[model samples]
Target: MDFSIISENLHYYFDGLLITVQLTGISLLLGLIFAIPLAVLRTSRNFILTMPIRFFVYVFRGTPLIVQMFIIYYGLGQFDFVKFGFGVFQEGFNPDNIGNQTFLWKYFFSEAYFCALFAFTLNTCAYTIEIIRGAIESTPFGEVEAAKSVGMSRTMMLRRIILPSSLRRAFPAYGNEVIFMLHGSALASVITLMDITGAAGIINARYYAPYEAYITAGVFYLCITFTIVWLFKKIEKRIYAHLAPYVDKTQKTAAVN
Candidate 1:
């Protein structure tokens, strides 16, 4: 209702929205970079190769993203390995008058933004690998055999057929993951990342109007969500257009008209 408050704080919202978008984008990029290879290895029968991926996926998926962020940003700070990881740099950065915290401790744990990004990447990758793996496994044996009959090598089949088709099938689920990561970026506020939720918090504190502050933030999130859905729908129509054979064109036309 208090639109003026939002107008006054527009700059804060803009900065926070940018931070949220950046965090989600970076996390998805990192997750995608690792998840593909990890998914392939995860499908392998070799326990040695697969076990590590499995364990990583399990741990990340099993735990809360917030907990992971805390462990990296705070919990690991309690350990000597993390503390002494870069001793030389640690000593160089330390100065007197800073209470109880050392240079290394402050350097690693003090960066909540980095910690949140790292945690989001790890968590999203865990879920994404599974999404991709399921898609890959769902690829028909007949199609693979058809590729083989056409003289495609295993590597060629994967690169040209399986990977591409699997990704297409995985897109809908992957899009949901992207949106989830966007919303999850709000948790960054807990650690002072100044994301959308953080901006909303600041607004509430400044104006003493939680309704106005949070409703505006909610509108921003809703707009982002709608945009993502529209994009995904466009992608889905493009990728799945090959289903024309199973669908009756006349009925489709009639339904559309």
Candidate 2:
């Protein structure tokens, strides 16, 4: 219908798409980095090491992502410490008379962007921990026995065997997690971050064309989903190459024809 409106505001959608990618990419990277060590620790028998990580994962995975974003974005400002910019200013403070001291609060809870990133990072990290933990626990019993026979210490076995093998096994599941994270990034718009969904909402409000606005946004998301699926498929094939049944090239070509 209103193709002209979409054409006119294509740049806005592109900008929003960029923000969406940045948010998802950074969140996934940080989540994976933190989850690796936490997952390893989570498999330990010691309650001291495992309980805190378990509780962290439980709380994040148990709550809605929107609630987490709200608590980080709107709730933090209610505190006097964050409200006053970590004590740099008080009530009715003037921007013109700002102090020279660097304030750490301004970069974190004080900004919607950082708050959204913080929430997404922690939320994805919680799920990722469980994904990797399951992979680690599922390591074949014979492999563990072989490692023990060769006098491999826990640390050495994890380093040389368990982590590498587990990570490969977790690859498919993690790809799904990445896709979920991309979809979840839509919630960033709720916190005033102009992600793809945010751009669509703005267009719908301004032009009164809900179908055009949202369908365009949906197309963008679909394209991203396709790209992610293709990339992950490539990586998954490589990761599990050894398990694939060998096929003659001549037969493959004949089937294709």
Candidate 3:
């Protein structure tokens, strides 16, 4: 109903969208980087290594992401040791001076962006580890055996055969994970990060126009979702191109002859 407000706040909406994208990109990158090792650990034959990873995955996956975020952001701050270890407080740190520090100094450790990034990265990594573990496990045993038959070392077979095939099989699921991360980044706003959802909430409070602000944010999210889907589809096609069958008329003619 209020087209003018939407137009006037378009720049704010765009800024929020940028922040949302940034959070998602950073979190997803960190998650994937950590996930490979965790997945490997999960699949390891060593019970000592496998059990911890399995437990981590269970705890992270079993809990609601919101609860995890709160635990990291608020609950962790309750402990003096955690605060000190995370650099949230200096030696002999006193809470009374928290508000008097410069913005950068005060937020150096307790910033919403970092907290959100930490929470989302940890959560995404748990999910990605399971996905990657499944992909690795699903790699055809026969192929591994064939590689070994050719005198390939375990490392060589893993690097040359297993990882590549597993990557291809994992891409589709990873793409979905990417999209999920993007959408989940909206939660960053809850911790006061001015992501798209946060900006919408702020603008709605100021303008008393929740519908316009939220709808605009929703549209921004939809655009991001579409873009991610399209990009991943392109990646999937490129990666799996070799799997496509090529109909060779020349071969057919030679056979007939």
Candidate 4:
């Protein structure tokens, strides 16, 4: 257990930590943004509006995150259209011809970082949609009835009441989702993205100190987990403060006496 190797290469781990946080943070933010509208649509009775979203959610949620990342990173490159560009499919099929590659393929899909980001966004978005949809669906009937009684339009009611309440209710669950995404970001290392786990792997490879390398990575993850837990607890307390039971000071004093 030569832990000295970890101290020597601490900078690598810090760099990896930045990548992990950036990857996870961006993915979660984008996922939440996309999920908001999709979740509302999911709660709708309209099949046309809901089916496509349902299928998308099903496909992403049903599959493994690592498999999704691999398909995005490696599978897309296998296609000639992506490799050689649209010309291969459009003009003529020539095995030797390296056609003009697309800007999208060259700029985004061809890169490991973009591929991982794409996968992470889609994966997190799918889960977030379901999390919010469930929260929206679980909204109390009385509230809906009260809103309807007041002649509140569907849009107005959702904006003013349903959404606010549902979001508050979903806060804790969403916090958990954020943490899951953080842990899942480790998969980015598999695609050679140089995340925290990737840094540890490199250290282990060079020094042959598996315990030291991996344990240092584990400690970093644990610290992150604790910080997340603390932040969520604080936010939950603030958001749910109104729901906390109020006790009269006089009553407490009387009880004490």
- Quantify all predictions' global Cα lDDT against the true fold: 0.87, 0.90, 0.85, 0.92
Candidate 2 global CA lDDT score: 0.90
Name the regions of candidate 2 deviating beyond 4 angstroms.
Answer: 85-102, 247-257
User: Which number leads on TM-score?
Assistant: 4
Better of 1 and 3 by TM-score: 3
Q: How far out, in Å, is residue 177 in model 3?
A: 0.9
Clashing pairs in 3: none
Error of 3 at 52 (Å): 1.2
lDDT of 1 by residue, 1-257 (tens): 68898998888989998999988999999999999989988888999999999999999999988889888887876665455444425656443334545565666456887788889999999999999999999998988999999999988999999999899989999999999999888999998889889999999998899999999999999998998899889988888888645656668777677
**Candidate 3 per-residue lDDT over residues 35-85, each given as its tens digit:** 987897788899998998999899989998889999888886676545434
**Pairs that collide, model 4:** none
Error of 2 at 148 (Å): 1.5
Model 1 residue 4 CA deviation (Å) reads 1.4
State residue 178's C-alpha deviation in candidate 3, in Å.
0.9
Residue 115 error, candidate 3, Å = 0.5
Worst ten in a row by lDDT for model 3: 80-89
TM-score of each: 0.86, 0.90, 0.88, 0.93
- Tell me the spans in candidate 1 whose CA falls farther than 4 Å from its real position: 86-109, 244-257
